[model samples]
Target: MSDKLAILGGKPVRDEFLPYGKQCIDEEDIESVVKVLKGDYLTTGPNVREFEEKVAQYVGAKYAVAVSNGTAALHAACFAAGIQEGDEVITTPITFAASANCVLYQGAKPVFADIDPKTYNIDVKDIERKITDKTKAIIPVDFTGQAVDLDKIMELADRYNLTVIEDAAHALGTEYKGKKIGSIAHMTEFSFHPVKHITTGEGGIVTTNDEELYKKLSLFRTHGITRDKELLVNKEQGSWYYEQLDLGYNYRITDIQCALGTSQLEKIQKFIDRRRELVRKYNEQLSDIDGVITPYEEVYSNSSWHLYIIQLELEKFKAGRKEIFEALKAENIGVNVHYVPVYYHPYYQKLGYKKGLCPNAEKLYECMITLPLFPKMNDRDLDDVVKAVNKVLSYYRK
Candidate 1:
């Protein structure tokens, strides 16, 4: 313990501070970026298409559209799904703002669904209660890498004729009932941020099998322009001629990012395997701690373990979650809260949403703490995290 503590200031236990999540770079990743940098096209090129095709194949979808980021992917998905003003999209409150903001982008209202207390994903039962004639879709977030109960959500979607666009930012490598996550939903969105299962610096993809939807997404990604001479209502009769089919933003991803993404995709399995191993170790080490509740995985789900979130057992803690969090930070273990209920934000609150709308999400928000878990962390780092957590728990546990 003394030597480990000395390593902290002597040089820093990590080459840099251990972030909760980060990109895993390797020799192949570097070479791929260099190749793209030296290539002819930088953006809207063949590599973009190749990356899309590879992702589509990997996720078992018919088409994949690369975009600037996950937010852009969600925006395109919402637009293609036909979300409009007065239309409502129900989604979990325990996700990044993009999950709900995408609906707002299309001028649709975002309805919040409370999460399952056990799985911390959207509660299907609660989602059913929020549905109405104006409800057009449900964006179920695969929170923290655990696959949402797509079967239940799909059943509801089938009953209501609502589209299902999965917010799979945290679930790039997750599986549900033996099927890959993107394949199980009508439309699936993936993120390639540094913290995600893979990295492209900042990139995302939309995957779907519906040809019409795929066409819409394709055009929506690049200023609504279509190179397809066939879709032109009036052709210039030249190969270079193209047309803007509708109002769309320039959400195209660069070749450099795609190159990195494609390279990162190759090591996705390794990243996921390592993350899963770390999660297992955390679960085992924290299970017996009186004030900590480890993450839960559904029997039918195989998670990518993008984040390892734990809930504080309020009954067992004397100082509450905030105090415990600060204590861990003081010990040099980076800890963070996953989210504040989306409705609790000022933007949503302005829209007539309130604190009590999703009680489960609010309750979870109070106790949720995201631990540092990444492929770069070694056993010593793991021990530091576990020990820090234990030290905090012992100090606060009643």
Candidate 2:
């Protein structure tokens, strides 16, 4: 590797460009999808139920409802929580817009909360401060795959009589206090996007121990329709009778996608292990480097390592995050930022959300950078990343 910075016209770190995240699809995964193709039913079939059961069992939850995507999962969870106009939901601003947009979808408002500076999870104290009588729910995101302070959030929910809808999109394999994230919250949501721990092609699911919530989520996944006789108003109808009891959307996940989900679920443990191993190497290589702050892990939680975000100590660096980001990209390092504060977007601004709402989260947004991480990456790939980061940061250090 070259000792000089690539942005300064020196030799680049690698001959090929590396991506920040990607799916690991193998022949077994292909075979699973092919089997689904040969089956009689392609959607709303046995594979969907089997994948849901596998996910629920893997996370120690009693029930799971599969949906079209993570956004749909959040929308379904919001519907199940009964959030509506004039209702408020508390959530951290340091997450994907969908974390808050789901609230908007239900004609409700999303109150912005700050984040824990170290772990980057939602701040419980801020969540409490943002709550009020109008606050009907809390959607705490497990940012960067670290579990939020579930114990504290659950306690607050109890104190305020608020529903807890955990956004576990980045935390499929994460655990809090030895309990899996999905099993701990009132309603936990998981995404199976290509970059996630597993891929359902484009799908999501919600898991809950409450049967009532399970029913509501299931109804919401479909068009609020039900065929069970016990819950139906007309008990005398024939076997073909089904009714649309409540207003819902078409958010069903296909049997084809579920087949891929079931196959991918089989290797979650292996995927998580490799991610943890890569993170350890990142910590070792980057820990001693100046002006770079490695991610912090709380003793009570084991993160799934969905993203490896590093914060730049701006005071120690001569350049800001954008210049540094470009420098690394010039070295063939695929660096990305996990999020921009949700309120900072123009759409939120037009919705009357202001900047400086969550100071800590805003500060973190200015310094954070997501580095390349996935199960398929090897030691040399990790080394190349370290070398590029060191080279860029060293050249820009004040």
Candidate 3:
């Protein structure tokens, strides 16, 4: 092992930088987008409906509503769940801020639940403790593409008469107890960001089996304006007549994006397979390394493998996390942290949240690093990442 760290003038493992995640775009994806561009309807057209139907069918849901982005999907789900002022929604803290911010959008309070240290999902016991009469919904996130304890969450929701909206942004192909993530939740939301399993530039969709929630999602996406004759309260003056039924935003996604989503969805299984393979390789190679904790996969879950995060035993390392992170970056490995606890941010701090709210999430954030694990990575890339990690850890060993 080298005496000096990579950041301290030692030879680096890689000559080029490898980002933690990336989009896998193919010729077919480009061709689909081009086809949509050449067509007449660019926004809110047949392609959008087709993409929604395809997603709903793939996830075994009765309906899906495609929207502008993941944040909008959460917002729409909250709206459909009837989240309002003075309402409280429970969710995990170790997720993207959008998960909790979506509740704030509905003028509701986000009651953050602590995580299960082993699986890094929200602890059901903590969730149960946080529940109250004012709790209108529980928005459990499928963190790092692994399904949360959905059966337990659903049971709690049923007992308390609360809605469950699954924030499945990282779990496009994840499964729980043989059911797809989107199929089992009361309502599930998915993101089509570039870093996700599938890309549509930037888009989102909500899936549900309830017809009432489906109608509400559809209405919420298009400024609450519907021309459906049956939904109209007054007699229609003409075929072109439409009415605004509720206060909603214009969160409609373009058909161009939907076309790309449709094409990307065709290869989602292959993408997931590649990601899982990479994760397996990571586990096999990194498991024996001292002080390195590989992610835990629950028996009930088949994770989509959106991220491959490793937690370092901080007590065993001579260097701090920042030093290790910088050392890895110097080796041309684009490592990143998944998140800080949502309530630990400055905005949330100003809103009366403090640092020690979720101790497990805070502790996880301090030592975890996300490794490069995109579907586009090859054998050489994977080997290089492993080498860099090992080299860095060896150098910093206590």
Candidate 4:
């Protein structure tokens, strides 16, 4: 191992910090938000419907329901799918907690499934093995924006008479076998957080082709209230009348955020293109480096590249993940870990989940590091990230 330290003698790659992921906003995004600020309605208004329509058309889905945030979107989908007490939903453990927590929101059990180690996605066979009589749904997450094997998952869902709700928060522009992700699944959820492909400050939406599911999602998003005359039990109650059909939450998003989302959606293709370009550059630069393993992309799908993750060969390094992570941070590179297996969390453990549930996911979590990848990043930013990673690894190599 090298004796020199960047903190002591060598110059850092960058003077400023570079975050793992960030939103790209411009004049148009600002202008759109300003327009909404001056509009008639800020909460549930025309902009929300227009944004939903634009997203539906973009993803080739028939209907879209905008919600407060990604977690809300997942909860709405689970509720719409009729996930109740005693139901089991199989999903990958190598994802954000919200992916599994949504199942718990409906008083359903979330069954942890191991991931395909190479692709870092839920294993299809593992999903099949986890299914039982109580299984009512499968919530396959598109980890790091790579689309899950929807065909296989859907086949399993069909065989078991189960609903498939895709947690596609990381994948907005991703395509699988020449088809958009949102259009393929029974119901798909998207996030518009600052780190996601698009931003509405903090917002999410659920997309689907099923009309009944769409209706349920809409109702659930707004406290289960309905104003449509056709759906009302009491006819001729007057135009001012509304009714609460079922128990639901107020997961509604404001038009101000939706306006921003609509603007960001217009540039989504460009954003995705830039992210892909950066991933390609990172792959080319780091693939042959010792003790480093770049992300793997399956042939059947094109990833939106939400987060570019690298797996470290810990056996070949004297330093552990925490040391390397700190080294990168010392060089002004903002790196992160995508997740800690959902079942490993204290709350999940309290709910009867344990550490050994998904070995592959736990193993992956031990070695993986999320690097910076955003549309706003230039060649210099990419170079700095690559340089910092190389410096850390070389100094720590055994």
What number of backbone clashes does candidate 1 have, counting pairs of residues 3 or more apart or in separate chains?
0
Clash list (residue pairs), candidate 3: none
Candidate 4 structure quality by residue, lDDT tens digits, 1-398: 34355665666778999998888989999999899898799999999999999999999999999999999999999999999999999999999999999999999999988999999999999999999999999999999999999999999999999999999999999999989899889999999999999999999999999999999999998899999887898978889999999898999999999999999999999999999999999999999899999999899989998999999999999989998998888888999998988888889889888788888998999999999999999999999998888888888888
Q: What is the lDDT for 379 in model 2? A: 97
Return the TM-score for candidate 1, rounded to 2 decimals. 0.95
Compared with the true structure, all predictions reach lDDT values of 0.88, 0.94, 0.93, 0.93
Q: Mind giving the per-residue lDDT tens digits that candidate 1 earns over 242-342? A: 88999999999999999888888888898889999999999899898887889989999999988999998888878878777766666767788988788
Off by over 4 Å in 1: 1-16
Candidate 2 yields a Cα-based lDDT of: 0.94
State model 4's lDDT.
Answer: 0.93
TM-score of 3: 0.99
Q: lDDT tens string, model 3, 213-270?
A: 9999999998999999989987647998899999999999999999999999999999
